[model samples]
Target: MPHTKTSDEVRIAYQVRGDGPPLVLLAGQANDHHWWDGVRDDFTASRSTITIDYRGTGESDKPHQPYSTERFADDVVAVLDELAVDRTDVYGTSMGGRVAQCLALHHSHRLRALVLGCTSPGGQHGIERSSEVRRSLVQPNPVDARQALLQLMYTPAWLATHPGPYYTLGDQSMPTYARRGHLVASNRHDAWDALPAILAPTLVLHGTEDLLNPTANAPLLAARIPGARLELIQGARHTYFEERRDLASPLVLEFLDQKVPLQ
Candidate 1:
């Protein structure tokens, strides 16, 4: 229920779990701090996991203006500043990853390691969402929208075995205006040219079966960031980290703990 104010005066809500070295978690569009609920336990077991709602979502201020990933990145730094965390590991997925890219470029001083999950560098370099998937993302009906999104984010085989729990949670209260703002921010995010500026040890994790962000984005992102390591989850989709956090958390833990090679 705590909040931090950005330079632009937007208040972002954040939550901290567990206790250890800091680990900031950025959520995707329309998601707040609770978006990481699926993996919080895993991440918190070894790290002080921090998750925040981007402006215009969850408990954060909903400013009615075109949003950009850069601003979202600044919000992350703002939260870290409020907590007096000089530097810590940061991980982001989807829109959150786009924001993390901005953070690495503009606020590298606050990060020890960077993890980008199922994300892209935007501006044509990112993956293209299929028309159906795109429509599903913006579907007006909440239930129908969630169902549609689940289909795209999880493979049919995975969905068959895992049902209810994975589908029951989210920020759910995201307003239409806020959703549009995040969509605008996501579309405007273009960090490809600036990726080389990231000095933090970086890891780009993607799923072999991702549809929304696409598997092709992994290599492109890894190659652009200086010495970024790319790891692929076989048969996984956009929500791989959530669906298989049990399998994916170790990879993140090792990377953040510096047990694995950055290359």
Candidate 2:
């Protein structure tokens, strides 16, 4: 149980794998570090991958205080600092992408590259999840939540073909208050104005069928962030990186491996 203390003194539990350049994997609103279990091997084959539990998720602290993306971004920076890593590539999905945006804007020097997946800049400028998807998450039981996620976060073919993985992806060990804190914090995130300040070379990937963070957000994010590229995975939903790893992983690896022109 490797842990790091943030500036705020919150304990952040994290895991590291492989032994090349560092790559951090940031989990989403409803997930902890364990959420990366499904795809950690894909990146660990080359890069030194790091995945951490958000303050209110997994093994991190939950103090009942208000949460913000800035706070989460700081935690990421603290994790890197604790590991004595000056900079590293980051792959952030959903809510974690919002945190990544904050990091890239505020801690530009600490990033080698960035990959934003299934995320948005927020406000009316970016599209949102469907009402059906939204409604399903409110106070739903685990069984219901799993079913809804499988329907909205994954394509029918992937869900049908990968039942085992699909079921395992539903694991969420965080408490209700903590999960609610993440939701509240994520809802308040609005980084549209901050996009232009992200100096890190970036790749914006989105699933065409992602109802959580609509596909339109991808191109919008890319256009706003200078030098950012966009790629839309066909028929993929929110969890495309896992549900459609065969397609998503290659793009991520290629992007991570390529050299970013000096600024």
Candidate 3:
């Protein structure tokens, strides 16, 4: 694992693997780079893949300070600056998607393409998860909470065969404050008005069955960004890119490879 220091001096950990065109993979809330374990190789087969452990997870230094998606995006920019990557495509899911939005908005020069999955713009403009889904996520027992999260992230059939826990549980070792910071940052994300200004070719993907961020946000995201495209995977859940990467990865690759007229 390689590391870079942000302007704030927090050490952010990142990994670069394989070769060819670059693609940065951003992790979801409280999750580390391993969140992409199931689909990383797919992208890496043809493109150099860069994965970053946001300031509060994996091997990164976690400081007890406020976190915002914009700040998280800056952490990514620091990593790219350290690696000498001038521009690359990006794929982000859940909280990672929120961070990606900020990255595209704040550092437009650093991206060639963008893919956002199962995430919202936050604030009052985005569609929130249902109250029932929200309650299930906060169960006192870790076991119950993990199970509930799995249910929301994958289909019943997928969970039936893969009973073992995946990356959906996030970093169990993450500090309480770091977790809280991630939650607050995600809750405050409001890129609705700014999305239209994005110049990179963008793709918004969501599972039709996604209950966490809700599938509606995908189309909303696509519509908000000028000339962005939306794709909904049928029968999949929040982590559709992971659970059905077989179907989703190709869409991402195709979109990244296509040349869209500059907006």
Q: What are the clash counts of all predictions, listed in order?
A: 0, 0, 0
lDDT digits (tens) for residues 1-263 of candidate 2: 88999877889888889978889998887678877778888988788899888887777787788888888999998889989999899999998899999889889999999999999998778788778778886544867876776677777787677766442242366677777788888888999988998888899999998887788899999999998989999988888888889999989989888853322
TM-score of 2: 0.93
In candidate 2, residue 98 scores what lDDT? Answer: 92
Identify the candidate with maximal TM-score. 3
lDDT of all predictions: 0.84, 0.84, 0.90
Which ranges in model 1 have alpha carbons more than 4 Å from their true place? 136-144, 165-170, 259-263
lDDT of 3: 0.90
Q: Write the per-residue lDDT of candidate 1 for residues 1-263, one digit (tens) a residue.
A: 89988888888888889888898988887778766877789977778888888888788898888788998888888888899989888899988899989988998888889999999999977777788778876788978988877876888887898765662234568778888788888988888888888999999998898988888999999999888999999989888888778778889988888832332
Stretches of candidate 2 exceeding 4 Å from the true structure: 139-142, 165-171, 260-263
Candidate 1 — what's its lDDT? 0.84
Better of 2 and 3 by lDDT: 3
Better of 1 and 3 by TM-score: 3
- Alpha-carbon runs more than 4 Å astray in model 3: 260-263
Best by lDDT: 3
